[model samples]
Target: MSDLATLGRRIRHFRTAAGLTLEELGREVDVAQSQLSLIENGKREPRLTLLGAIASRLGVTVADLLDESAPSPRAALEIELERAQSAAAYRELGLPEVRATRSMTDEVLRALVGLHRELDRRARLAIATPEEARRANTRQRLRMQQVDNYLPDIEDLAEADVAAAGHGGGALTHRTVSVMAERLGLSIVHVADLPHSARCVLDLENGRIYIPPASIPGGHGLRSLALQAMAHLRLGHGEPADYEDFLRQRQDASYYAAACLMPQGAAVAFLERAKRERDIAIEDFRDAFGVTHEAAALRFTNLATARLDIPVHFVRVAGDGAVVRAYENDGLPLPVDATHATEGQIVCRHWSARRAFARSTRTTEYFQYTDTPAGTFFEATQTGTAESDEFSITLGVPYAQSRWFRGRESGHREVSRCPDLTCCRRPDADVAARWEGRAWASARVHAHIFSPLPQGTYPGVDDRELYDFLESHASAPEE
Candidate 1:
């Protein structure tokens, strides 16, 4: 939603607010006054270092600079710039100043700009290509259905109930988002209260996003947070919601990383390859350029989905020790019936990122929507256990799209992967095979996220089902 003009305007407004002139701010950011002027006018965009310099000069967070929510009337120009930016990459080379936009320098810029353009363009078209959008739409519909399944019942729980069941010594409440945020080389902090206080807490470190522990007793906290995520998406670009803010947190981290990995000029040339390749998921692109997984994932997500015709999902899990981290779903019900997915178990949740998923054992399988019940995610309160608040995402992807999570693709190269390389995996760069009593007969194994425990899974009334059913029966609510 943000563009050069938005950055430029924010720079100007903040510079004025900070009581400094463009020349003065440019001096602080170590850029020439004219260059800063060009950037501020939306004719040029600044790199992270420059943006940081500008933010520092303006006395604001870079995240704050990227914050396009509630666009001022002045922000409209930036939106126009974004559109032009799309065409520049797809058609022209976009260096308005360089009449020869397609020159080498222009090619470089277009590569970087191209993905955004593709992502943007696709989202706008009434047509949903049979590619990733079709896949994404399927997932979105399923998730939304799951969300709908649980939304009306939100009134049933109390914030206190959720919080009481929530895990953590409030570490995430205090801990900043270390991985994606810091990797982008931004200066940020974790705050007890957020820009939208009483709604959720925020960590400005790395990227600007809010994290609310579902532990707030009385269920008010989780409900409020859910409302915010839904509202954020509903408002679309330049509006606020907990989900996009969360996305902003990741996207900011991912986008900046993408720029650094493939500078605008260099990436345009890369686009020509995209036409030749299937979809450039993070890993594939990383292979093209040899980058880190996190970096690739971040970049893929930040890429404008509309331009790339790629869909990225904002998948997250909060487990550490105890309740791990809390998750609040806005549109859909929380997956995994009880606790939120934790960091340690991402591989179990998503198979593509880890090596484990390819080894098909009876333990791993896809649960159909018909089998999973209406609610996809289950929020819960736990006590007397470390994993009390910890939960897993529901594995109920319909038979149609369940294969994407497998580490090996059975079919075509995707233009993009939802949740942006969203196959959950262990935080560790590499992983080994270990069995968890949990993956069923193939048995639940603790493997990396990219590796699903070797199977698409089969549904049968096994002893494990009997056990789970028995457990649920024992715990089932009273009439």
Candidate 2:
């Protein structure tokens, strides 16, 4: 239906529900009865101010009157596919254009939908050029930044689960893990030959979890991994059929795992004590909870936002300057492209995350105070190894909150005017002035460039080879 018709229908419905006649609404909104009638009949479009007045007088929002009913999900998908077919990208993909009509047969529609789905799958599986990946990452980062990296519903559910598990007052332990597994009727089995990338897998059909032996080395890592796997079951997450869903599910699982590892009430109490002591250390938190630095940082953010009422930002960056992961619940300005891609972009060397790599000793924590266009931030960073890659994780808060954190009194400070050419710390000029032609830094190539198609399409894995290996191992004795 036309915009005017939809608006008129909504207005009429609201007016009837409010038991207001045309004259009554007109008088309250200060519009002529004839004009209101004309608008209600779709003969005229109302002005914005007048619409707002009418909506207010009718006890509704202007949007309620203006908004039209959305199309069905499947129909919306069809519309999107049609639009894609008309785009240069789809045309370049060699997919035929699909047009829809009321008289089209069900078989034809199904065929068109199937063809579009196949083309989309192929496009995703195709090796994305660096430029393509960058563009996609930019879009993803923008969507994430717009929300300030908070997922309230998931956090609420996680906190509720923590309370239900009676873990509200203490650090999580193996006993808690065993109790949870038993409560859920899940069997945990250690597998020495699990894939390096796979931490733990949930076999829902068998009510069992298969985890690598390394995950169980007496620290809370084993419990964390088990909880991570159980998150999929507890949250009722299903097999993700798309990349976006896969990322979301993984994030949810990670959040749930963190929540289990650091129960909200206990974590908040710990932070309160740390804040009072003015010694907020990520490592201290990590050691206390038997979690990784990344997990500790994430849990800190959660507490900062949900409990302590402090805004914070956390980032994990690889040696090559690619952002592996990031989260912010504050107005910290991040270096991003027009598309807001945070990953795979070279961060400014002046930022604490990048500066952390310059430390002479990789094990020691590095702290810095940086002044940016947004605000001054106090950051603490440390390096850790993930698989074969070395990365620096930085946790930062606004300068106002720095007094409550450790390393705030550090004298190592820098001024950064990033995403602009005039920034004092220009990598080229500053580095060149320092080293001239003597200092040489070798660039490291990452496996991500040529690794398997992400979202679990093993790029070069032969199905036959995989099947044969599995068959050969089927009767092998378990550890």
Candidate 3:
């Protein structure tokens, strides 16, 4: 079906170009002039017979009248203005609608469209300020906990896609991923100048998915990126409605990619065997799936409670000690601000997440038991480098479940009273007394805190550049 707005603009464009006023055209089509005016303004849907008569009078086929693209630059502007005014974002503003009429100049239309776009942009910024983003993330995290971080629908989809690609037991290979893309009718293309803002761009129009020529950094896999791009289409995602929607889509895509890399059936059987042997480990999971340690740890959370009957928590901490991402259903106490957001919040110095940074060994995973106010938990931490930044991935469970995992017998342990301020946040009395007035250090600032969210259909992407890239490669020979 044609977009009514586009159809209306096209009709008006053709009628004006042919030098026929609404009254004249209506008479030729045997319709009232007022109804014809309403149809031209996109206020009314015309019957098929009326459209055919109008097309005959306009000397064009119905197909031409139904073309999706605007008939002219002015028509495009009008269509854009109409869409913006009708959008929920605009309606929420409670502003009076401006109707484009014959008296409105092209310059005036342009100004109106531009103003609405800016207003829309500002509104989005307000909706997702840093604090709002954190709170939204916190809410999302709680929701994940409700389901034990398991998404059966996505898991089922990934299992189907992986099996269709002829994947058997072991790590999913690039060749298999290519087959998966083929099954979805998408071809992967590598380009050196891929946009930095986008991890991968799916060109649905050309049946091509463009990725950067360089190998994905930070222990990420090219298969994972391609699979994620495919997930968006398979999952029927549209432009995210808001920041929360964006976060959910992103997390779901990541979940789908992980599920594809580690098929739930094979992964569950493998984990069950490890459980039988009492030696489950993230490194082993990572090695088995040929995925990053962080990926393996997160995938474990996706299945642990739901399939293995063991609750778990996963946390990624930057070298500087800020929590990058966190999820738990194991009754572990994590530091959270008033908004309940764990991101950017500092992990306790005495906890395994922070203490792992002090380890001298870089080749092996670190294991520890931490006694927190909530309970005693056993944790396994692994350090990895991604995009030149060092970070640690920690997976933990309640002490009772430790018997089923490796590193359960490790003697390393610590006591934490976090949220108490004195546990890890407060300095020693003597140290504080000595440095209270003598020490001064400037804080490093992050510009992203105040920066607006990236602007585009896909956040941060340059739509024009992407379109040009797609056009240049639209007819290129397939690799």
* Candidate numbers sorted by lDDT from highest down: 3, 2, 1
List TM-scores for all candidates, in order.
0.24, 0.65, 0.79
Better of 1 and 3 by TM-score: 3
Kindly list the per-residue Cα lDDT of model 3 for residues 343-390, writing each as its tens digit: 888888888887888888868888999999999999999887889878
Off by over 4 Å in 1: 1-255, 264-272, 279-281, 314-479
* Model 3: lowest-lDDT 10 consecutive positions: 212-221
Off by over 4 Å in 3: 1-83, 93-122, 125-127, 214-220, 442-453, 462-468, 475-479
TM-score, model 1 to reference: 0.24
Ordering by TM-score: 3, 2, 1
lDDT of 3: 0.88
On residues 1-479, what C-alpha lDDT tens digit does candidate 2 reach at each position?
A: 35564566578778988999999999998889999988875579888999888888888888787777422443444455565576666778685665565577666776777776676666556646555555655555555545555556766776776666666455676766767876788767677655545666665655666676754554667877788888888888875544555556666788788887877667778888998898989889888877888889887876786567778999889887777777675777776656566666666678889888777887768989999888899999998777887789999999998998888779999888777866733558775688887777887667676754553333233434444444544555544
Deviation (Å) of 397 in candidate 2? 1.4
lDDT of 1: 0.37
lDDT of each: 0.37, 0.72, 0.88
